[model samples]
Target: MKDSQPELLHLDSDEMTGYPNSPLPVLIYRQVLDTSNAEERADSFEAMFKRHGWPPAWRYHLYDFDHFHSTAHEALGIFRGQARARLGGPHGQETVLKAGDVLVLPAGVGHASVEADDDFCMVGAYPPGQEPEIERGDPAQLAAAQSRVATVALPENAPVGGPLAALWE
Candidate 1:
């Protein structure tokens, strides 16, 4: 059976304790993959990132608390199991992500895993030559983090689409 086009979800920011949430909307692409093998699915996600000019991907689970990447945007593809995640900030929306789901988070957008199954895993990647800096809602570094986020360049293509990621444009 042919799969349908994925849906796009744009989430706005809500002010956190001392950090300024991202101004860009968080993009969610549901069921981007269908493979059941964890390793195969992760490899597929990595291939997609490479094709879209994003590289240096890694495999891991998301941190369980609210955090943001100050320097680079991130793409997370769920390869196994499922989880409920909070996006935007402390007061952001809660969303469920299952295997095959993909989430593209713009710079400085907060995300946390509220709950997850034991088998949950994800493949994460960044745009070419971009290194991610972790910011854990630190009040002292709020200004610096916000500045970095503002200056971060938007990726030329969305991780899932080489040049046709309409939601990213």
Candidate 2:
């Protein structure tokens, strides 16, 4: 781990469109892993997440379309390659994420991959007992989504430990 503070990003809800972004700020921990070896990098991230109570769930690319999960927060550890991702929604914020970076998204925060290298991949995990349900920005589902998001529990520890864990608190 980096032994440093992570970059914090706060995104407000997009009420007009009905995407209920979280009250918690997004956390970006940069250069926190050794991406030189793909298999080892993935193993390291999985171990770290599991050790911290967040279980490693999947290894894949970020979806190409905009979506949010109202039932659980997410922790994505970039293991290989790089990409430009949109956070919040289609018109939200754009950011670049490379291997060795860890981006933590609270429940209801919209995200999608805008562009990515062919080799880009990530390890995604969630807090114990939290399973993610995909939700596109649909106004009709807004009421139920908002209720689920509001009740989603806060994570006790960050996927990346050390100083980064304090961000969740």
Candidate 3:
């Protein structure tokens, strides 16, 4: 968390690069904010987006509803929780509604989740390549309706032992 750390990130804009052919956005598993007050959440979310280029024009949300967050990719979480997603399948094939579940949606993949309760919070991720078309129920539905979506294309200098570690190497 040092301010002196290098903040600049460079990436190849073409698919001809050697990086993994990522079709969907990399879904990140971030914890819920411990603080109350919408301002704190807004501020924290703002910082994350700014530091990682999750544009203000992009669709992001802190949903105060009961819902499931699913898309593609997998094993990009901190906690050990049960998650189910049928690779290259249609909607309803994915499931990850637990206390600490981190699911990622890869390119060309689609998913939807069922909320256990009527309250909670969630973040979303779309596909990569030529921007993805995503769909969610309510609260986070606006992001689903966008023309295209963008996500952080695993940085080259990111730390080891992360979800994108091997790819970085």
Best by TM-score: 2
Q: Write down the lDDT of every candidate, Cα atoms only.
A: 0.78, 0.88, 0.31
Residue-wise lDDT of candidate 2 within 68-108, one digit each (tens)? Answer: 99999999999999999999987789999999999999999
Ranked candidates, highest lDDT first: 2, 1, 3
For candidate 2, report its TM-score. 0.94
Regions more than 4 Å wrong, model 2? 162-169
Q: Write the per-residue lDDT of candidate 1 for residues 1-169, one digit (tens) a residue.
A: 1133455556554434545567566777788888768888888888977888778467888789888888888989899999999886677789999989888888888889999998889989898767887777766777877888888888778788745345556
Check candidate 2 and list the clashing pairs: none
CA displacement after TM-score superposition, residue 19 of candidate 3 (Å): 22
The TM-score measured for candidate 1 stands at 0.87
lDDT of 3 by residue, 13-36 (tens): 122211221343334333433344
Off by over 4 Å in 3: 1-32, 56-88, 91-103, 116-130, 135-169
The TM-scores of all predictions, comma-separated, are 0.87, 0.94, 0.37
How many steric clashes between backbone atoms does each model show? Answer: 0, 0, 11
